[model samples]
Target: MSKSQATPNSAATGAESPDAILFREGMSRAAAAVHVVTTDGEAGRAGFTATAVTPVTDSPASLLVCVNTASRSAQALLANRAFCVNTLGAEDLALADIFAGRTGLQGQDRFTVGAWEKLETGSPALTTSLVSFDCRISDARVVATHHVIIGEIVGIRLGERKPPLIYQGRHYHKL
Candidate 1:
């Protein structure tokens, strides 16, 4: 089964313990889309992969993205108040790993994984990504280990026929 679709009661199948039931349930219920959030401002250029993006409103065109409070990209995005969401293609796994810290790239260096450019909003966007959304911060809130950042999309770039890259259960794929 796909990691995002893992059975919640694996232990019922004799594969996990009851204590981990809630944790497994969390994994099972989390259906996410992987996207790279990028920014460039006084803090310099930076990008990070996230699966926490979600649409919030259609009329005003807002999206919510949860970012780890401790990440550099998170810090930069907050400071900039502008970011680009680069939806990856199936072959962009390496780029995903690079931005996600799985490939050892850090800070601004992570942006070198692929071709990048900028949109009208001055947000850095991946040139070969399946789609890119340039956004401006509308509001934000810090809750526990993550920051819920809401943005209003001001521009968009949709690429050619490219499938999206996905991440779940610490694995990557497309479908």
Candidate 2:
């Protein structure tokens, strides 16, 4: 018989927890589609590049996105109560960098790079995106350093068929 080693539970034993760097490094290995999530309304227009969005259900047609609390668009998204998830095409890498705050563009300036239109929720949708999901905020909650925002789909716009932009290992990739 082999000896089994007992692992200490961090929550119970109050041991040192895994650091944020380690968590991010692990998550970086998971490939995800790139999207620019936008919002406009009483909170003013705002957006940011994100990869944390995912479909929550099909019955009511809903999805969720995790936004960093410090993100420039977080407050606007929460206040506007609506958003659009524009899935980027492989050729849209420049647009992603613009919205991700890598080009020094902030606020409305970031939108100047793309042809934007509004669907049902009045959030800006990229005309060249692979697809856009317009939604109204159904719920939100804070978890760790991010806000988990749930959106109920109100409308959808399909653009030209193209390969989606993917991010993994801390870099952009095309499939």
Candidate 3:
């Protein structure tokens, strides 16, 4: 998610540069675990499908999640100052689409499809997730069009170890 930006070469051409296009195409081939990051607080409830979550350290039990600034859930996630990264299993493909905005279900409505519960941070943790990292936002930085949030893990909920849901070649796969 913290990919280095392509230098500003499109100003004259008014089109995406070749390097940026190729980078995206190459990245698409790289498989990543799917996750539904959910949050709830004064900003209400919000969730989104993300492949940008990763661990930063374990001493303080921290992880990083990247969210697009333009996403509808961005404001709530930032304002809430907490979130849960629910690592999906193979069975959760439809749930991923629901949270990813493909179903047109906005805000709290997306929670209707899943069995969710709050952990230490009061963020919604999917009961069926392979694992749910409930965290408090420790730090945040804006890089390009995304918010790179570092979260301190305050709790973890482990579910059955099942085949993981992955995204690659712009499609969902199970492994």
Q: Rate the local accuracy (lDDT) of all candidates.
A: 0.83, 0.93, 0.93
lDDT of 1: 0.83
Over the full model, what C-alpha lDDT does candidate 2 score relative to the true structure? 0.93
What TM-score do all the candidates reach, one by one? 0.83, 0.91, 0.89
The candidate maximizing TM-score is 2
RMSD for all candidates, in order, please: 6.0, 3.5, 5.0
Candidate 2, residues 1-175, lDDT tens digits: the string is: 1223233467998987656676687789999999999999999999999999999999899999999999879999999999999999999999999999999999999988979999988999999999999999999999989999999999999999889999999999999
Segments of candidate 1 deviating more than 4 angstroms:
1-21
Over all chains combined, what TM-score does candidate 2 have?
Answer: 0.91
**Quick one: ranking by TM-score, best first?**
2, 3, 1
| Candidate 2 all-Cα RMSD | 3.5
| RMSD versus native structure for model 1 | 6.0
The digit string of per-residue lDDT tens for model 1 on 18-63 reads 3456565566566567899998888778888888898899878888
